[model samples]
Target: MMEKMNQDGALETEKSLKRNNVVRERRISGAVAPGAGAVFRSVHAMQSTLALGSSFESDHIWKLGCLDGSSPDTGKGKSQFKSSSITNKVCHGFHLVEGQSGHDMEDYHVAEYRKTKAHVLGLFAIFDGHLGDRVPTYLKDNLFNNILEEPSFWEDPKTAIKNAYRSTDKLILEKSMQLGPGGSTAVTAIVIDGKDLWVANVGDSRAVICRGGVADQLTVDHEPHSERRRIEKQGGFVTTLPGDVPRVNGQLAVARAFGDENLKAHLSSEPDVRQIRIDSSTQFVILASDGLWKVMNNQEAVDMVKHIKDPQAAAKRLTTEALARKSKDDISCIVIRFG
Candidate 1:
């Protein structure tokens, strides 16, 4: 297995290196604005050649929204993750673009309250939970803030990301004891210094970039099978089954995530992170639950919204397309456009 990984590692590593960073799920509790009801809370950051509300006119992708899904109750929702986006102007014309979860609302919000910077970072995530709801809710509230708040982020991003992933997973596992049997699969994107986008994922939630009519994947879906292949070659059988149903070990469907105390050895809950540099050729980005990607190919999605003039419209269409394909999982998408 080590030999297989070494041979493919270059490819995987290159892919990982070309696009990599850190991002996840949590609990929430607190008072939100009066008009917001049953609405999941989201967070995002951005860097641009233009200012907010300004008619964007340039070659840079604008960091737009982060979209995510959560169940009102902690136990019955999708894996929670962050979905960040951007858009490309292409040949001519303007494009429309746009852009949460919760529980432990207070801690998450308080942490969010600390990131008072003025960048427009978006949140599009799906919190898929098993055993309980508390952990997802906690992620809905805090993970984003934690990623940025870490001291090592600016100096050693990969290290910072690894640390954050493990730390968050540990915290979720610990809290779940009191909160519920909660553990969550997540995908998150954060715009750093405005020039880069970071995606961190555990499980199957996916992040994809549309460039030149090709769906450029920004992150990989960690699964027991992927892990299994790696481990099996190393003289290991971490999971009882393979192929038909993917699991971190033999227990969960997600490859990385928060909580899952019992599945720790088989499933580390650590995330794979990547950083993306957006340019004019970059059309848009999508972040969604497994339900969406399970049914659609990356390039297919890019083609769906490629020439469309409005990102929000494209996002809606993309989600609709997935549903039309009979995707039974919850679907959420965030679309962003660059002028």
Candidate 2:
């Protein structure tokens, strides 16, 4: 049965401020392969320097970034690597968390959290790799910097988001001959200026928010099943015989992704961005990968965490529940409790 909120379950959880940050790196290094473009310079350092949701208000922000993720292996199948000093900072609130385990030895992770202003701003990101883990690792290290440094960031968050996704995807592909089959999926959420939020997704990872304890999925699952209607509308063919999860183009499960040179002609990495302003009705938020949603629905996740009264514990509980359900993919999650 699909997951959902139990009728009698009334979650009333309230957490003041609990933020977790994770950062690690990939040992695989030595400049972009052989002919990759001049490694895009670091654009923006993680801005833990700003107090986005601190003394000025009652908000909090936290994030977790995984440098080495579970993307596909490299050309020789020797895991991709990165310079020890390259920054691989990823993930943050906007209520979201992603963790990686069982990956090869070359990867690392890092995270940060802060509270300032009258509201909370959370940053959450997930980088799923392919061909080799290096591309995703590079994305984990530089995606945000690309976003923050974009000229449109402050003026037009949505356009900035679209631009960042394209620019980053192009950079990865342009350098792929050197990196070899280099690519990854990126999903990000920014809870800005306090009550407003912006979500951008490339690939299957997702972003879901809670309002008055009810979950409102902000990002769409870019899966074959989810896109069947649109796919048909676009003159694409799909077998709906229903056996196991739906597949796009008879291979991948997601309708879009980053750096799938083979799929780029048909698939897309361009993000679907959304801007939402918060009010008193807002409650909390959850951001996670397909591993979590594959086994649980938005409302079910919200229902379980709502009454917990502890954001961190609730986040873990959600992960555990997904595991028990036997989700095949690596699972990661983050929860942001609001005032």
Candidate 3:
């Protein structure tokens, strides 16, 4: 009888041990479950953060916008527009590349098509800034609007452009504290009905048109050296160091620019305007900042991208070529094609 009791006791002990083991395993699993869930949640949150970062980069880095209720492609610094007129069939594209200057891109551009009651206007511009991007950003946002707002825009676009540029500079100078103590070089092109092209510029940003398979520069580069007489007449001296370009008062490089509050007395915000009739001989027009012009001439840039059928590809090719040529300034380019 004692042997049978011992056997029963042993069986009960084994059952208790099994039950205890099961309870312990359940507790361990319960403890690990929350930890595993927390780890999973952390990984998911990290992925979400990474995605948000990518979106932020895309939206902020290449912030191209169209004022005519159209959205710009935020993938890269590229934009394009086509005219609505069947007879004209004008198209344009632009590309921008940030330089290796160790600063944020100080170049801004505008390439948009606006429809009015009578005509479709293609407006394009480049604002190359110094010291800061605030001035250029303001120009990109407000310059064309100010130009179109002028009452004499339709009757006399040149005077209208000049007045608008002057007034805009005044406004910028008036708000210099808010816009920062910086300045910008501007080149603006307005194409009306795809036939009449009005180009204006201040400073070194240039506009070149290809006609009869040759490049015809339509705008003048307002260099400090060339305009030294005027700059000195305005109480600013042009200085040229041994290995540096000419600068006004040993500071700003361009003789004529917009929004140089400290140097406004020495600078001229007046733009040189030219109006050209787009004809069969006219092939394309290129508007670019000095970054491209510093390395490539008007004819060379024209020849390099003349064969490119797509304007976007042409603009990209020009900027890519500028980078390949070791241009270390922010490069911005716009190409308008008229067939």
Candidate 4:
């Protein structure tokens, strides 16, 4: 069963898993203030229910918020929610701030929970776009759905995530005419029954988990300089000019990303996938775009918010710190606390 609250604040229920793919766009005209996006919360308990579309549903409460390019707010917002399982309590919060780049916010995120027949899935991701927000927006709506649709998701999650990322990149390339000549870096995490976590990434967006008070990075940052051989083998060159990071073919900065029709031949969208069993030593997980990582190290971030019990406040603190450090890129962050 699926329940969706539309823009009019009306709840609509669907009995089946089959649903239309509708892209909802909200246009904002002025600078958006901090925490100025659509915020909603849903609560559910453990039950033997079918998976409802891509939205969150279960016995636990989850909060989600996304800001597309339409918001006029100086590109800042926050949202958070908490949920519990028989073994652990899960709570998540996200914060976003548009950079001083003089452009609309080009970062998007997803943080919610869903119930399958036998498990509760915590789905979270960060998509950071360059050139345009279209690719990231598209990812926000479709990437996780495609990953879950893979036949091997349950038995071979690593392969399933890789296949889904490749296929999704193909779709984005095919739709580049509409999505624009841009691309997005993605980092995704799937937590099963609040215990098993599967993380995958393409490009720089990163995922870090805190275990026993130490920060363990779960995602790889696919940088052009680090993967120069791969790019050169594909007839692409990595360029390093003064005052600029290495770039593929002197164009894109990352070696892997979704979309980028013009650079498709040089870039790869294959994600590095990793899986870990969540246990007692696990404290929390952090997912954020390069904006935050550019200013803070994994340990610094983990330490800054480890003492903050509220996940939402923790997320905000990270973004606020990044801004204080003079990070000039759009910043997006998610904090998932496990206890």
Per-residue CA lDDT of model 2 for 171-207, tens digit only, reads 8778776545545556676755445668788666777
Per candidate, the number of residue pairs that clash is 57, 43, 0, 15
User: For each candidate, what TM-score against the reference?
Assistant: 0.62, 0.63, 0.77, 0.77
The local lDDT score (0 to 100) that residue 5 gets in candidate 1 is 8
lDDT for each of the candidates?
0.50, 0.52, 0.71, 0.71
Can you tell me which runs of candidate 3 are displaced by over 4 Å? 1-86
Runs in model 2 lying further than 4 Å from the true structure: 1-121, 225-242
How does candidate 2 fare on TM-score? 0.63
The sequence of per-residue lDDT tens digits that candidate 3 reaches over residues 49-161 is: 01211223212222222233323341112112343442355666667765655444567777655667556677788898887777887898899989999999999999999
What lDDT score is found at residue 316 in candidate 4? 73
Which candidate achieves the best lDDT against the true structure? 4
Global lDDT of model 2: 0.52
Tens digits of per-residue lDDT for model 1 on 83-167?
1322322111111111111111111111111112333343344554445445656777767667767898767767777787777
Q: Rank the candidates by lDDT, best first.
A: 4, 3, 2, 1
